[model samples]
Target: MARWQDIEKDAPEFAERVRARFGAGIHKTIATLRKDGSPRISGSELEFEDGEVKFGMMDRSLKLLDVRRDPRIAVHSPSLDPPKEAGEWLGDAKLAGRVVEIPPAPDSPHQDAGHFRIDITEVVLTYVGNPADHLVIESWHEGTGWRRRTRE
Candidate 1:
């Protein structure tokens, strides 16, 4: 686990890229464990605020049930395809995090709903440029923001 400061000094440009790639009307895949210990998957918009990602669901949604049963969850943002030429963005990233449900607000759109936050724990970066096949992993934990876990 690496603190936010441990990673390359806040790469605003890179952060912007990430936000643009994953944030633009993109849907995130959320996976949680069911009461029976099975995996339940759902897709929802990835909302970013104060550096954290959030998802909202109706109380009747299976996702809310799953999260209530198990807080551990994983989220993935699909790969963005760029121009087939060099100088274009050519990589994909996935985020794995822990989910924490937020209490619904009475006047909120989710008032009859539930909200879950995905606290990013790890990130996987895969490069698809040229020869492709390059990958990198970054892990985060308490007291740590993000740290390189592997490079290949």
Candidate 2:
């Protein structure tokens, strides 16, 4: 797993694109695992602070319980579509990884909520080119640096 800062250092342009989409909005989608191995979708607000991607949840929330039992998680950036006349959509960003639960530090800003740092295993971005051009999809993983593909 790599830190967000490490990714930025290694791939500046790609990291900037992904981070922009991630910061486009606060209410984003998060997928988590339930005890029965089912999937749960919830809203989350992630903070890119101190070179880490972190988030908090209400105490005893289902998502929190899910994280406690299984650390695997996936997060999606909020959608921002361009107008029909425009060709500059900001793109979609996604992050998949394990969550590391950490006790609040003595100097932590948020002490009332449960906080976790994401150990990013995969990051993906999707966007369209010109109207006549194909849609582009790019992905970065822990072992695999970056891969890209296009579709009509």
Candidate 3:
């Protein structure tokens, strides 16, 4: 497992890449644990700011409740296949993290709405190819980028 401290040293560049590739307004599917240990999946837009991934939702949503009960969550960016005729390229990334509820910012868009910051604990990157080998697997944290953990 890669140490978070080492990863922290390269946070800025890593965060910049993530922001450029999968920044705000990008749709992410989050899988949260239910009270009974089942899974609950939902979609939300994610913003990476100040080294953290933040998501907002209505205060009354079941997803908000689910996270409160259990902070473990998995997030994936939806993949779109490039047009075969056009020969466009396609790729996708998956992230798993622990959720931390940030205090509502006064006069913020989500003030009345609820917001949660996800401290990414791990990440897997996959490209469109035969067998879909994971290009990278690492221990990641908010602010810090991904660091090689174990080979997959």
Candidate 4:
């Protein structure tokens, strides 16, 4: 498992772009596993603080319940439509990891809310390439570090 700082250390530019995508908007999406082994999607927001990626859920939120039952999770940055000129598009980012629960602070407003920090397993950034004819995917994975691929 790697922290956000590890990515910054290994691939600073790529990490910066990925963080920009997440920071572009406040609302993102999160995926979790249901009790029956299916997938569930929920609205979420992420906070990058102190070299960690953290998030919170309302008390007894289904998403929080799912995480407690199964730590595996995936998060997608807020989406935006591709620009009229494909080359102008900013693309999007995604990350996969396991959540570790943290105790809420004593003076918190949402006192019983679930708080967590992710131990990232993977991070990906996908965007349209030059000439607007292909797609570029740059990804970072634990142990393997960084890799890039292109698709037509």
Q: Against the unseen true structure, what C-alpha lDDT does each candidate score? A: 0.60, 0.87, 0.63, 0.95
Stretches of candidate 2 off by over 4 Å are 105-112
Best by TM-score: 4
Report the lDDT tens digits of candidate 4 across residue range 1-152.
99999999999999999999999999999999999989999999989998999999998989989999999999999998887899998899999999999977788898789999999999999999998999999999999998999999
Kindly indicate the candidate among 2 and 3 with the higher TM-score. Answer: 2
lDDT by residue for model 2 (20-98), tens:
8988987989999999999999999998888889888878799999999999999999987665754576579999999
Global fold similarity of model 1 (TM-score): 0.70
* Residue pairs whose backbone atoms clash in candidate 4: none
Ordered by lDDT, highest first, the candidates read: 4, 2, 3, 1
Backbone clash count, each prediction separately = 5, 0, 0, 0
Model 1 RMSD in Å is 4.0
For model 1, the stretches where C-alpha displacement exceeds 4 angstroms are 1-15, 86-89, 129-152
Assess the local accuracy of residue 85 in candidate 2 as a C-alpha lDDT between 0 and 100: 52
TM-score, every prediction: 0.70, 0.91, 0.70, 0.97
TM-score (C-alpha) between model 2 and the true structure: 0.91
- Write candidate 3's Cα lDDT for 1-152 as tens digits: 22223333556454343444454336778898888999988988886556567778788788888888888888877655555633233445667778888887787876767688776666654433333443334335555555653233
